[model samples]
Target chain A: MLDQLIYLFRRVFRNIRQSPVLCSAAVGTVAVALTILAFFSLIVINIQSLAAHWSEEIQIVAYLEREPSPARLKQWRDGIEAMPEVAAVRYVNQQEALRRFKSRLGSDSDLLEGFGAEILPASLEISLREQYRNRESAETVVGRLRQNPELAEFNYGQDWLERFEAFLELLRFGAVVLGFFLLFAALFIVANTIKLTLYARRDELEIMALVGATPWFIKVPFLLEGALQGALGAFLALGGSLALFQFFLRQGLVALLSVTGGDQIVFLDWQQQLLLIGTGILLGLVGSVLSLRKFVRI
Target chain B: MIHLYNVCKNYQKDAASALHNLNFKIAKGDFVYITGPSGAGKSTLLKLLYCAEKPSRGQILVNGKNITRMGSSHIPQLRRHTGIVFQDFKLLDNRTLFENVAFPLEVQGKKRFEISNKVYQALKHVGLHGKLQKYPLQLSGGEQQRVAIARALVVDPLILLADEPTGNLDLEVTLEIIELFKKANARGTTVLLATHDQEMIRRFPRRVIALENGQLVNDSAP
Candidate 1:
């Protein structure tokens, strides 16, 4: 069996060497299709990470109508912490809120020379659990907070964040559909490419069959051909995508995205990359098998 | 050993049968000739013996196995023990002569050293050992046919079936091809040669099973 496999491998390489044009056409098609898929997949992965980072930073500020005593503030903190949706609550006194504002203002801090700690509001900053970070759940939590008589004003950055999430969801859906189409295109192109190869060599295959060659003996070489094409295509796609990704990084896209306080863009992780390669190999094998169905019968 | 009983083969249900009900038997190591004119079902008979085409009716026993009812998976096993040479020489144009002859032994999954040794021996037997690296088109029609014969014989099959192997060769080349068959038969491989060349048939006398109009008309030994 090992000897037969060696012969099959040699035949596969011989076929490729004889028909370089067809093999390149096959590899190019797969590379283009897989590159498209990898591009969108990477986008989806990073966008999802960005979305989660923004959601985790979500918090609501409940300004108090009057400054409570330290013991009363502790009681309010304990009450908010008991709520299931509230992950944690911090009592930000007027002094602390003023200091946080000054830090945010950075170099413009001198412009606030006349401002006093009394001018800042003492508020309860509420952080919601992951499950309650969405717009509807946050609104529900805020509605109940508004019922508190001691609260003067409630503020949370929900409007723009909700819209951003909706846009991301739409983008994700489009990426998924596009990914499906790319995979289909890859399979179709590989199948036809291999079908042409099979047609060109039908005489040889017939002769092999005539000489008592088993179906596997005839099939293994073609299968190997397809797999090699697919893998090469996938690597080509990876190379192209990696180059494009590097281009984006060099152009300061990572800095641009990081300006909003989220981490820089990430490429596909090792596991996802492995999955993509596996998908490439599977597409080649399937395409070759589909093309061989009719010819093998002859 | 081979046996056929009431075997029928028809391509289409409404068309005339390619082979009508036929019955015959050839013992082990028997060299026989299936002689017929064009469209006499000579090729079809050879195909049936190798499990290429199933009989429309009746049964065929090749070495005591019911080939007519053999499963598709078992067909390869049946063929592994049989070798076939075609009229067109069916040589792979892109492969070297050595690769062409080495194909069958490779199919058997023999070791590389064994396959190399056997292929060399078979090519030597056909007197074309010096042209191992040559392609099919690079050689003459005679040389190509010799390569095909070497390919068939390299497997050392129990049964050798040839379908008008020398139909395109001249008298000199035709006799040379027959000499290879004579040598293979001498080594105890049962041979079945299909041809309409009466001159060649007269020169190399054997058991001749003559068919005409898809029916057996004679079986003679001279």
Candidate 2:
């Protein structure tokens, strides 16, 4: 068995050496395809991460019609906090709300000089649990909260959140569609490239068959060649993606996103990286199988 | 130890048969020549024995194994026991002589040390062990054919089938190649050489089986 493996390896490497140009072209095609996939995946991953971060910060604020008694305030807080989706509920008085507004103004607090605590309404801030932070759950909580008669108005950036959620859904759909198309295109191109290589070596293959080599013996080297190309191409694509990621980091795109409340941009995690490499290898194997099915006999 | 029973082969539907109702039997250790005109189905008969092409009708038995309806997967096993040499020399020009001769042994999944020993012995048998590293393209037509024969015989096949193996060589080289086949036959291998060279046949006579238009016209054995 070991001897056979050694022979097969020798044959695989020899084939690659004999047709370096064609093999390189095949590898390059895989690399280009995988690199494009990596870029799109990076975009989707970061966007989803940013969306999660924003969702965590979402809170429902119900403005009070008038100042309530201390007992009434406690009653409202206890009721809201008892809800399954509500993580916590805090009551902010008129004075405290004005103070928060001034703090948000930073150096421009003078713009609120003429305003007083009397103009601002006290509110109950309702923060949802982690699992309930999505648009649907938030809306469900809001619908239940609207039954309270003491609440005059509610604001949770509903319009912005809804649009953001819609955009995210569309982005996810686009990613899947685009990913399928890219993978199919890569498989087709790689199959054709390997087919060309097979044709170039058809004479050798015929000789191998003539010498009583089994079908597996003739096929295994080509399969190994395809797998090698896939692995090499995947690594090249990862390197290219890393280089592009570093280039963007150097250009301060990540810093700019951070300024807009986005989390730090991340490349594919280890699992995702493995998935890319695995896909590349699978692409090569399938391509070789497709070409071999029609080109080789016995 | 080969037998053909009313075997018939047609390459295409509604086309003339390549071989028709052919019946013959050759015992072990026989060196026979299949001689006929260009389209006399000499190659087709050899192809059938090696399981290269399935017969459209009838049966063939090599070493008591019926191979007429052999599956594609089993063809390789049949071929491993039967060595075939073609007219084109069928050598990988990019590979050296050692690699060429080692191919059959390697296909058999022999051990590394065993492959090396057998490849050297096979090359030595053909008097080309010293040129093991030479590429086929660098060698003369006769030398390349010798390398092919070495590759074929390296497996120690039970049967050696040669299809016009020396058609491209001169008289001297042709005789040299014929001698190699004779040597192989002397070592207990059943040799079936297909050719139309009457001079070579007359010079080194054997059991000649003549075919004309896909039918056995003569079998020169009482």
Give each model's clash number.
Answer: 0, 0
lDDT of 2: 0.90
**Predictions in order: chain A TM-score:** 0.82, 0.92
Q: Model 1 residue A152 lDDT?
A: 90
**Model 1 root mean square deviation, Cα atoms:** 3.8
lDDT of the candidates, in the order given = 0.87, 0.90
Q: Write the per-residue lDDT of candidate 2 for residues B3-122, one digit (tens) a residue.
A: 999999999999999999999999899999999999999999998888778899999999988997778888888888888888999898888999888888878888878988999999
User: Where does model 1 sit among the CAPRI classes?
Assistant: acceptable
Fnat across every predicted model, in order: 0.60, 0.76
Candidate 1 displacement at residue B35 in angstroms:
2.9
Writing each residue's lDDT as its tens digit, candidate 2 over A86-133 gives: 999988999999999999999999999988998899998999999988
Worst 10 residues of 2 chain B by lDDT: B68-77
Candidate 2, true inter-chain contacts retained: 0.76
Per-residue CA lDDT of candidate 1, range B1-222, in tens?
999999999989999988998899998888899999999999999989988799999999999999998888888788888889888999988889999999888777788899889999999999999999999999999889999999999988999999999999999999999999999999999999999999998898999999998899999988
